[model samples]
Target: MNPCDTMLADDEAVIRALLNEVPFNGWTRTALRRALAACNRDPDDAAFLFPGGAADMIETWACLADRDMEAAALAADLAAYRTPARVRAIISLRFEQNRPHRDAIRRAIAVLALPQNAKRAATITARTVDSIWHAAGDRSADFAWYTKRALLGGVYTSTLLFWLRDTSDTDEDTIAFLDRRLNNVATIGKTRKAITDKRPKLRIPMPGFMRTWAERA
Candidate 1:
């Protein structure tokens, strides 16, 4: 029998009572917050308090959120500190990239023609990114970025469920749609150029017609 099952064999099995159960009553959050506070208050305690890999991951995120980049970078260098939660610590700091980062992106696109491909791409990407950032604006300490990062796990989970329920090749439908749109756009451009090149000019009256009429009179 599984360890959990053996423990649950008797109603009085206190050990098996709550193992592996998801804590929905805020107890988990409270414990996590208290642990984090203790570690923050005493650096010496971190070696003892955060003995596990999970603790290392949690503290790594804390360092980044606190903007102690050097410490954050150090923690990130450690294998145990790497986790999806870490990606989120940076994303949550998404208040806007600092000027240096933004300047770098701007410079990369500066050589492109303004109001054209690169300009249009930059504008659309910013609008899309803003909508994602707003998804976390109401939370303190950018909890939105945390929740958004968590939502990535949901994407794969949801896609699996969709594939199971879908009766047709959804991938094929998507491909065909893209193919048709591309063909229509290509044909329109070709047709437009042809028509423009063949368009005729208006005729002007001949001065010879007036001179001939005067000679006849």
Candidate 2:
């Protein structure tokens, strides 16, 4: 394997171990040290592995989760489903994959919610939604690309918040909530399409400022 791949695999191993401690230690350096020890790695290696400290560990864990979600989506052959259903499946897969580490996720959310971690939080969200869209077979490179990700980002975040609190069987309620949000976005998209169809001249290009904003996101 490539050296970089090996390094990332090692990092992921440490992060996986870290998840076990996060629920009790709340993503602190102490928790990371314990995780390293659990992995039979040097505790001092924590600084080299996650220089940004707890926030870095949280972000890495999230990115790893995104990769897992994407791989699962692909393995499930989502091309047979409609775009919305495909997206729904991808998001559901994410929740399912992380269910075992829900408390770790909750703790990570608390860390990410800090005012200083705002940028990191946004970056992680953008990456996650982008992964979802890609896994759903979306190949749009136009303005729709940005809009779709932005719409899904809101749906994803809201569904996530709801899921964290949901107590229903098998997260049935969370899935239902996700379906409703997806349906709403679909309705809005269709309405906008209808309007654009009726008034060709109304199909305006994405604003330059908005484009810049989307790029940053």
Candidate 3:
């Protein structure tokens, strides 16, 4: 992947620079304008920079997190780990890297979780998991591609929520929670594969009535 492709634009960097001010000003267009003032940028540029207002800021923040996660993964030595371990490592790196920005992240999550931003939120979650998979050296091009990312999405989101609320001083509790979620996903995948492999494939269709009754059973 070209690192430049994920590089933040000047406007995005400006928005990120204002995260510390988010709690004070909130993630509004007004907040952005005020932030621009502090940065010696034109407040009128806010519209040009984030036409979607807070939604844009939140979405950009998510994208930035994904890019940072990928960069960290690239710098780390994860070659020795298996696929599951590597996935967990990449996700853990993301949370750890953003630890200092937890408040900003929490506020971003609130903005993304709004009813109007549901689709963007889902897109951001999907993209983050996709980046993690790529960084973990996954080369799947078939059904596993979707399944793996989908599973990780669930794991990562749950673990992030846990981390945000976790009171553990060293964050060991959050790490354990993340590990359990990943382990559960692995177990479920193995169990599903075993079940699928053991089930006989039927070339002939059963009678419609019988199939309907079987489905109810």
Candidate 4:
């Protein structure tokens, strides 16, 4: 691999390793530096690797999760399912993959939700939904592309937050919540389409003299 790719991979590894300490250290730069030091790497490298500190770590964590989700999607046999089913499967796989590290994930989410990190959070969320769509075989390049991603981003973010707080066995409650959110998105899309279809077409108006003549006749 090229130097840039290799460096990025190394940085990602370091950040991921730091996550094991997040639940205790609170997802701060100090904890990341401590993690780097524990690995016998220069603790100062934390600044160079993640300039935004905890916020950067949070974004990178989501990216790693996205990559894991894509890999799982690629390995699975999803040919039998339709588009929506494929999407649901990808999300389910993503959640399952992160279940082991939910505490760290929750900490990251809290960091991302901070006011200073809002932009990074939105960007990361957008990237995640886009990646999920790509994994689900969505290749649309039209106006619907933006709308589809917007709708899915909302659903994914809400479902993720819900899942983070869920306590049901095997995450059954979170899965049900996800289904409901997806259905809501589908319902909104259908309603918008129906409204568009039923809208009355505009007509050219005739002159007042012609209208009076026709009425008199």
lDDT of 3 by residue, 1-217 (tens): 2222544577566766778678777888777888788788898888776667787777777777787899999899899999888887888898788877778888888988889999888888888888899999988765556667778889989999999997776678888998889889989899868765766673545457646655554
Candidate 3 wrongly placed segments (more than 4 Å):
1-8, 201-217
Worst 10 residues of 3 by lDDT: 1-10
Model 4's C-alpha root-mean-square deviation from the true structure amounts to 9.7
Q: Candidate 2 has which clashing residue pairs, if any?
A: none
lDDT (tens digit, per residue) of candidate 1 on 45-115: 33443233232222222223223332343444433433333333323233222222332222223322245
Q: Which structure among the candidates has the greatest lDDT?
A: 2
TM-score versus the correct structure, for each prediction = 0.19, 0.89, 0.85, 0.84
Q: How would you encode candidate 2's per-residue C-alpha lDDT over 48-72 as one tens digit per residue?
A: 7677778777778878888899999
lDDT score of residue 2 within candidate 2: 21
Cα lDDT, all candidates: 0.33, 0.85, 0.79, 0.80
Clashing pairs in model 1, backbone N/Cα/C closer than 3 A: none
Q: Compute the lDDT of residue 127 as modeled in candidate 1.
A: 34
Ranking by TM-score: 2, 3, 4, 1
Ranking 3 against 4 by TM-score, winner: 3
Instruction: Write one digit per residue (lDDT tens) for candidate 4, span 95-213.
Output: 88888788998888787878988887888888889989999998987556766888999899899999998887577888899999999999999996776566555344645864665
Q: RMSD in angstroms, candidate 3?
A: 5.9
Clashes of 3: 0
Off by over 4 Å in 4: 1-7, 37-40, 199-217
Which stretch of 10 consecutive residues in model 4 shows the poorest summed lDDT?
A: 1-10
